[model samples]
Target: MLDWMNRYRRNRMVDHYITQLGPALRKRYGLREQYTVPQIQKTLVAIHLNTHYLAYAVALYRHEASRNTVNLRLSQTFLDSLRAEMAKRYFHGRDSYRAHDVLGLVKTSRWRGGRSADGVRSWVAGAAD
Candidate 1:
């Protein structure tokens, strides 16, 4: 019960923050009613984390928008802000491997294909070396 409540609370907070980001984003992009706050939030989160499914969804959603518009809206500063917020909320104080630590191994790995999904997996596996 306690765990469930905590999860629910966290979810609610996420939703709230996403909702708050909506207006700022819409205003930034000068988008009228085409995209809702929830949609924008989901897309931003997807792009920030480089999530496969969500990234696809966001791509589909942006099919109507110009590439320049999409690029400008999903700027690095915005993505980094969202990433930092998410890290603070979910991964604060958590021990994790930094990307640089594995970059050398990944770069040196002999994957069959270059930077494909399977290649990335192989790189990750070989990154232990």
Candidate 2:
């Protein structure tokens, strides 16, 4: 019984945090939609490459943005937080690393930090594969 209770507690805590992850990412990662599976996969890869610290933050962000999170405005605070998290996860071999794991970072960086909604639409149009 005690074990069950402990597991339940852990799951609940995880769920609670998961619920908050999306809003936080959306607020930070410039919530947008992935028109293609490859783009979606890449963005997911970017988050994974990053610290992935926010306990399902990616999922939450995806849900909230309705897959169009990138189309929405992003906050500097969010981008900074993401960059810091990525720096923590980034290693010496990061250049060879796959960008999909941290799709958010790749998108932001590739755009040179100035691509508007249209730019994102173009990226998403690519095949997710």
Candidate 3:
């Protein structure tokens, strides 16, 4: 069906980009064990903050694919383990109108622009509270 195909293409096209983003994410979080993008996605959903992760993932994927990077990384809780790994960085409010929902503008420090590799900035972030 066209619907199924569209959905699949819409979602699948980014899988590669997300995988390419793996190193940046692991390095930024100082992760010891390697994690696939979907595994990370599941973790975000388990914490009930997957929506933020999805939006940010799309944005970061776009950025990596030569698209745009105007989207904000929304706020939400995360696992304490990930929290401990990522909290040392600065979290800036990206949107004043939705100040409470804004988690700040984060950029990985290893990309071409000297930002990205730790892509939780525009790709992943947070606790599960």
Candidate 4:
């Protein structure tokens, strides 16, 4: 994974952060000078640490199945951590990104939040991404 990450990092353009990043990233996401490589790398590393913590938690959760009392409890923390990482990396730690913060996995707000969906779909209709 490290080998692949290094290769991808070196190949991707680092200059003119937004323009070289291509239209897929889109300007409307509010990408700025603050969203540089070093900043993003640090966030990714933090996410890595959270993932390790979750993994250990899952292992402990499995072990607690036979015990009457479970020492580990993080159902909420796990979800909150996951959400925080996503916000930090993608939305640049913003509370809200654009018109509507509705997140769609398969389609971009198309089937979800109707008002935001129609709004976003019409807005990005011309872009290649």
Candidate 5:
């Protein structure tokens, strides 16, 4: 598995992050009820693209798997590291880039706060902004 990670990391760290993250993301965030299949697919594609960029940043900084430690807990420190890296990459230099695509994934997630399907849709759509 580490070998595969190394191979993927060769091209772009984002690719490595996506390869590790895509399936987990699909399982964790893909919604069956928020929208139709086509809509969900579209959302998934957008989310995947966005996440890939984040993965790339994380990889570029040698932060692959840094978010979760051997203790098996997700660490805010890891996320802060990634976020700081992203900010530096996206905002500092003229040639830098931001993960706007990944940021867009915020709109595609399903919210379970509603009492009914319609309510959920309203809540989600409302919260999207």
Candidate 6:
């Protein structure tokens, strides 16, 4: 029961982070419907390389712009590229690592410094409308 609760909380946290991070990335990188599959894949690769975290990469991939614009084949290709980027940045020559391991290593605290959560929430809310 306790373990389940912890897992639930973690999932929620991941969801919240994804919701906030996805749109910000889209706006920053100018990922729009006009971008081709290869172009979208490259942008995703860039995001993973910059963040060094799979959760953020996944979030960015699942963003509305990406879903509406990027096709499955290209999305899979982007995932492969993201995995390679993760291996390069975080694996440090290690042979194996899980997605959770990469996600666990990401410091959410860094987000609190430059932009307040309230500000992000408002920005995201505004964008939604």
Q: Could you say which candidate leads in lDDT?
A: 6
Best by TM-score: 6
After superposition, which runs of candidate 5 have C-alpha atoms over 4 Å from their true positions?
Answer: 1-11, 16-24, 31-74, 90-129
Q: How close is candidate 5 to the true structure, as a TM-score?
A: 0.27
Off by over 4 Å in 3: 32-129
* Model 6 per-residue lDDT tens digits across residues 9-102: 6555445434444444456555442333344346556544333243334533442324533445336455555445546655674424443344
Candidate 2 residue 74 C-alpha distance from true site, Å: 29
Estimate candidate 6's alpha-carbon lDDT, on a 0 to 1 scale: 0.47
Give a tens-digit lDDT track for model 3, residues 67-121: 1222233222222222222223223322111111112233344546645656665
Worst 10 residues of 1 by lDDT: 97-106
Alpha-carbon local distance difference test for all models? 0.42, 0.39, 0.36, 0.33, 0.41, 0.47
Per-residue alpha-carbon lDDT of model 4 for 21-120, expressed as tens digits?
Answer: 2122223235332232223334335333222233222221121122211233434455345445445644567523321231221143235544553466
TM-score preference between candidates 1 and 2, better one: 2
For model 1, give the RMSD to the true fold. 14.6
* Full candidate order by lDDT, most accurate first: 6, 1, 5, 2, 3, 4
Cα shift from native, residue 32, model 2 (Å): 5.8
Off by more than 4 A, model 1: 1-72, 93-129
Looking at candidate 6, what is the lDDT of residue 125? 73
Residue 57 lDDT (model 6): 45
RMSD of 3: 19.3
Error of 6 at 123 (Å): 31
* Count of backbone collisions within predicted model 3: 10
Query: Backbone clash tally for model 2?
Result: 24
lDDT of 5 by residue, 105-126 (tens): 3343566565665577678879
* TM-score of each model, in listed order: 0.23, 0.25, 0.23, 0.23, 0.27, 0.28
